[model samples]
Target chain A: MKSVYIVDDSIISPLGFSVEENLQNLKNNTTGIVEVKDTSIHTDSFYGGLIDEKRLTDAWDALSEIASYTKLEKMMLLAMQRLLDKNPQLDITRCGVLISTTKGNIDQLKENNTDRAYLDTLASAIQQFYKLGNSPTIISNACISGGLAIAIAKRMIQAGHYEDVIVVGGDLLSEFTLSGFFSFQAVSPKPCKPFSKNRTGISLGEAAAATWISGSIKNTNISEVVEVVGEASANDANHISGPSRTGEGLYLSIQRALDEAKVSASDIDYISAHGTATPFNDEMESIAFSRSGLEDIPVNSLKGYYGHTLGASALLETIIAKHHLLANEVVCSLGFDELGVSYPIDVIKKNKAIAMQHVLKTASGFGGCNVALVLKKVSI
Target chain B: MMVEDYKITSFCSIKDNKVIVDNKVLYVHEEQGTVKEFTKAIYKSLGIKYPKFYKMDTLCKLGFLATEALLRNAEKPDNQTALVLSNRSSSLATDRIHQESIANKEDYFPSPAVFVYTLPNIVLGEISIRHQFKGENAFFVSEQFDAKLLTDYSRLLLDTNKASNVICGWVNLDSNKYDVFLAIISRKGNTILTEEQLNKLYHT
Candidate 1:
């Protein structure tokens, strides 16, 4: 497979809008989950990783072309603009943009009581706003959408179609999702605690993350950059919201990703698991990892710091893992004080020093969909 | 990604435990349960291994039933398979239910469980679990069906040996309407199809 590298990344979450700001907060264990004082908008005491209004406005000003966009669109444009600005060397024409989100401006539709054509309008808005004439692909694969976005870009680049692809994923905590999570009984009253013995449910977060991928794109002296080695998606066909009790879908996704990478379970240095803190999700993932004989690998979930950004989770997690890989350190699984599931696997609770090579990123979502990706550090 | 004979084994629209198939008219503006019920009825009659009641969704039930029928005649591919699901309205029904909760001030608690289905690709996840296919999978959205894009993507997956076989199709459910056409496309050296062939089979 052709090598695909991460050239640049930018993020806007509760922590801050820039990549460096988010990373700095993460190092200090600063969580973006907070109380929403505006309960009148939705009668729920839920926590969300909301972006600051002033920062968001400034970000919109930077990408003034999208000034007319709604709140969600502005948030997305801000992330994209920051990423594009960071990598001005690459020509946008030779690149393709892949946007991933579940409800692409769906909030606007709900507010206006419009029809389904709202999606088309959103796509057009993006095309005109970005000033890109090429066809841009949008993915809304639940929580796996962000990771799948990278996988799609890798396919296009590996197929010798485009050298560079801009992948931007974002989602907002609209009343639509707030009610959905509440109806399902999966919302955490407090901040989410992934893989915690006292864990209750996930905290919905809004975030936008952008990453530039290319064969030629590179940063200064960054040898051993994170490389997309392999990625795969699998369907559970077992349930809609509930995961397969046997972890069949997750097991298949992991197996396929490893096969594509031509690497064995023992080769992986660590695993950035999709520990959603939900009983079923954590249990299913543990069983799947054990089934794959990956029980010994160090693992952690970033939900404690970033909450579940839905479509943005996978890419955001990958960005965090990439930073860890580059720094030769392992991030602890925040909020995991106890092993809540029976499945046997080591969930890292402390930062450990190690020479990282290849790590796995796994995520599972509704409709029994699961995806696994392998990232290898490109050695000098 | 040349056209070849695409077999649709089981086309189901299920709800609760009931299954509906090709015989039932798919409603585009009705309750999700009606669609699920119609799909479940089809699976019951076909004698396929019935999925557990609680674990099945319209997407999984329909996808597996279709996949079972598509692969009934041929053996499972010896190599990994690619899954390409194209759509415009993905998991809208789930989104609707979620939206309703938020809209209702008295009962404004959005259930996290329902929130999970708001994702468009969960259908793909259901399909993967049913077939136990752990391979290259993607969900691409457009204003309308893009046959050229689908063909190109399928070709890319097959040509690169990403998967020896490719199961690509369009599955969408909005309101009560369910319109999906799935196909199993192996390498040209391995399989074959033409527009005339599909037109004759589905039309005539």
Candidate 2:
């Protein structure tokens, strides 16, 4: 019962440090992804979306005096601080925090001496830094962690566990992830082209996104409230590293999400897909869209701009989708020049204005995990 | 909202080189050895020929063995059964291995097989594939097993009709030490799956 609304949010990424800047970049078709030649991350130059180090340090210095925090922690805290700043009336002591991250302080493992590398320890640092009421729960379910965090927050609020919950998702580009993706040959040498015929692979990125989910929209400062209508996650039960050729898990997730939202496939206006640009991933998504009878809906993958931020990907895109609903426009799927995949799904090629009311966000990742969240716009 | 009382239909745990199902010790390895040897010994004792078990990392192997024992006699659960697992280390054992592969330039050969198991939820995926559980699932990482959180989440899923049955508990593996505690929670069973009871089972 209770309707959960994403009342306030913030995004810290390569494009910008705030949601406004990120949205402006999206509207201008400016991509944050570039050719990165950091030998510390990989042996060869690769494409990725990396936040400017000097800018990040300046932002952190302006906010806190705590210098011991890791880069990923600073990003998460900064994103949360921006959201909290927007809602001065929010009671931090009464809210629960859910952290969505695949590898928390994983880069610290290089020294092989830091205990803060543990996922729970990362949550503890955030909890102590904010003095929140409850110990922050860490969701580390591959790329679906962020979206699943939102879904879990919705359940917690609806079940009368917490009136409000703060969900923060962040991951960084490190030698660990880069080398692993490179090992799999999943890294693209150029800016990723999602759903494009010539798409190579995913361009890994680093970003942090935070959202305030509440049972009531009292202290919100937005014109339109984005309600988390329905959310569901399903496992492919197929392969660990590879996606299902039939898109079985993704189709189930979408179907379950739509059913729970009390809407049919036709009711969906836009789709924010997890287009990692890998040949198999894009093709799997296309088949899932067709199987769900949503082949004609305009779908866009923000990876063209933000790349695959891993755990931060779904939540970041969901926040952007909320902005799209508020502005009544569909941002273009950047880097897409030609139709790709066997199924004929309508991938958004250019930005266009539309009267969007409901949008679907889907993400599938390693370990055969797939999640879908339904968001609806409501006038206050 | 009307809340429903769910029960722990079956429970199993693996720790200290011993396998216990429903409070009964099924198998035990007397000699001290690595986690891999212990898990493989348990697999052989289970007498199942699932070769995929060999490919999984230690975490997945521990979780798979526990689940196999938990559902040995019970009827096969349908796809509506969701998995909600928690752990502390979060694949750090595998993460260190993956990190070591690329730590040196001369020996920089990161194998995809080893890299794929670097997530905590991959264990969930392994159990899902083994049981054909094509339903909602999530993996949480806490400093310790928080029975209250798991109970609350599992109840929410069952209350909302999102899942007919939920296999929820903790499976943690780190530094040659592994502990797995899993239980099937559903609408029908002899014992109510309360937070206190689940915690007691975990500690037992």
Candidate 3:
């Protein structure tokens, strides 16, 4: 397989827009989650982490001459624009864009509904704004779309599809999702506490994360990077919203990824788990980690700080993990005061400094989807 | 990376009141009803009492019918069958309905059952649960049915041994229009599932 490297990246979230800003907030334990009482979403107020409107629009207006993009489009464009501006050496013709989103502009249906509400339109808008050669590809595999996008990009590059691919994933806190989750009772009243004994449900969030992955080293301009060693996706054949009781799909996903990387559980240094903080989701991860024999590894979920950003969670978490791993540090699993699940797994509460080498990132979502990505820090 | 060629061992297409298998019409519905009612009629015609079929939106119903038709009799290891599907519209059919339910505060009652089917990949979960397909799966959205994209992705999944067999095709749905072109891509087949073959089959 061709060596796929993460060349450059950017994140636009409530914590901050740039990668550095978000990392600092995460390290400082400054959660973006706040108590929200938006009438458009639910009858009662719910806690969520929303991007500051002023900050978002201001940053977007700076990059875009006219603010014609939708909220989700603006977020995607901002994240990709930051990476594009930073890496001027990238060839526009050879690069492709992969967009991952569970709901892209589904909010567009709420008002001024048009064909533009479709996902491909959102992807095309970004592609045209950048004037890329290859048509944009949209990965819409529920919440795991972002993680699966990385895996898909790696394979496409490895198969000599494109030398460079830019993946930008984002989802918004629309009434559609909020109402739906509320109907499912999956929204947390407080900021989500993943893997906690008292953990209830996930805190909704919105974020856009962009990463430039290249198949060839010559295409990359970054000095320090992370290599995507292996990745895989699996289905539980279980419930659509509820997780499998045995974590069979997630365990298989992790095993397949490790099998592809030719690595074992002992080789993993740290784990970035998909701790949605939901009763079923957290327990599933524990069982999956236990099944994969990775129970003792230092594991953490960023949902406590960022909330569940749906499609953007996996990519956002991966980028943050890449940053911390490069710095040889492990982030805390915020809001986790006590272990909730039956399986014995290490869920770190505070940041731990270690000689980070290899890390495992796992995510499971609706439609019984699970994705496991193993990333190795490239020694510069 | 070089990958071994796989074949479209079996395929099914559903549109209007007819179901075509491998470019040949296999079943036609004489029932007169709306798309939902027709879907239910077709579901009954198969005589497979999977009661969950009625709850699905037009998207999942079409996917469920076509997939069940393709894998009705053929038995294989459930864990290796991947459900890789694409669409021009990403769950917009159900999204519109979902939007309608929540758009009006006066009649605000977003059914969890309906809201759950708002994602395009939920059909994958529905089918996986019904057939016990515990393997790699993904849902892609594009301007139209992109055969090359589907071919490349399925090849990757199969080549990596993540999936022993793949149920790949397009299941596009709107309020009135619906079409499903699902195929079984496996090692033990005659017709090689090349990009050209996929394009030809998708157009049917």
Candidate with best TM-score? 2
Which tens-of-lDDT digit does each residue in A22-121 have in candidate 1? 8788777788888886664456467777777887887687668535687777777778778878777766666888888877776765675455324555
Q: Measured with DockQ on alpha carbons, how good is candidate 3?
A: 0.84
Candidate 2, B1-204: lDDT as tens digits = 537689988899998778998889999999899999999999988897999999999999988999999998887889989999999999999998998998899988899999999999999899999999999889999999999989998999999988989999899999998999999999878989889999999899
Off by over 4 Å in 3: A219-224, B73-78
DockQ of each: 0.44, 0.87, 0.84
TM-score of model 3 (CA atoms): 0.97
Candidate 3's residue-wise lDDT over B39-118, tens digit each?
Answer: 78778888878777777778888899998788776665466888899998878888888888887788988889888888
Error of 2 at B83 (Å): 0.3
lDDT of 2: 0.92
* True lDDT of residue A19, candidate 3: 96
Residue-level lDDT for B64 in candidate 2 = 91
Predicted model with the maximum DockQ? 2
Question: Of the candidates numbered 1 and 3, which has the greater TM-score value?
Answer: 3
Give the lDDT of residue B14 in candidate 3.
89
Clashes of each: 48, 0, 0
Clashing pairs in 2: none
